[model samples]
Target: MTILLFGVTKDIIGSSTLSMPSSSEFGSKRSKTVKELKEYLGKMYPELKKLSSLAVAVNNSYANDDTIIDNFDEIALIPPVSGG
Candidate 1:
């Protein structure tokens, strides 16, 4: 699955695209969800753990981690923004 990282989240992971394990089995398959992906990101980029209330979006629609995602899908975590 292709994860679309935005703002600080993108900086945490360094690169945009990521390929982490989704299952326990060896090279079983890829998994996409708010929770699963969180774990993946936490490992790939531990900096995310410090943030709170990360907004998960699927195909531009705001969604939860439970939402099923596809390979061509676009997922982004919208952290809070500040305006002066």
Candidate 2:
């Protein structure tokens, strides 16, 4: 799966896009839900866990923790944005 990163997420991940292998290819370490994805990422990049709030988008719509994800889905990591 390919995840699009924005704002601080991009900075933390050190890239605008992150590619992850499918569960079949990655054995059992692949993320199958939004919650798992968050945990997976947090472990790989602990800085992500420091954010006050992190939002996830799947196929352009907001997704909850239980939201199921697949290799073909379009995912994005949107960090908090503060401005006047």
Candidate 3:
């Protein structure tokens, strides 16, 4: 399974693709929800706790915390996008 990070998350994670732990990968593994993934990331980088206001996407569409992630799904942790 792969988790993609975009925008500020990309900067924080230092990569686009995140590989899950061996134990978390298995048949039909859906190891995380948007909120869970955010908390896990905040644990890794405490600074991110201040930046929790995010728009998460699963398969290119905005996802709520209740959304489930399957191995085949594309997950992207993207912050709100703006341009001028």
Best by TM-score: 2
User: Candidate 1: TM-score?
Assistant: 0.71
lDDT tens digits by residue: candidate 1, 1-84 = 566777877787777655544443222355546677677667766788888767888889998778866556777777667689
TM-score for candidate 3, residues paired by index = 0.73
User: Model 1 segments beyond 4 Å from truth?
Assistant: 16-31
Question: Of the candidates numbered 1 and 3, which has the greater TM-score value?
Answer: 3
Candidate 2 has what TM-score?
A: 0.90
Show pairs that collide, candidate 3. Answer: none
Q: Write the per-residue lDDT of candidate 3 for residues 1-84, one digit (tens) a residue.
A: 587877787787788778766464232244657777666767776756767477778898999988877667877777766799
Regarding lDDT, does 1 or 3 come out ahead? Answer: 3
Worst 10 residues of 3 by lDDT: 21-30
Score every model by TM-score.
0.71, 0.90, 0.73
For every model shown, the clashing-pair count is 1, 0, 0
**Candidate 2 lDDT by residue in tens digits, 1-84:** 899999999999999999986643332654478988898899899999999999999999999999988888999999999999
> What's the distance in Å from true for residue 47, model 3?
2.7
- Residue 30 in candidate 1 has what lDDT? 56
* Model 1 global lDDT (CA atoms, 0 to 1): 0.68
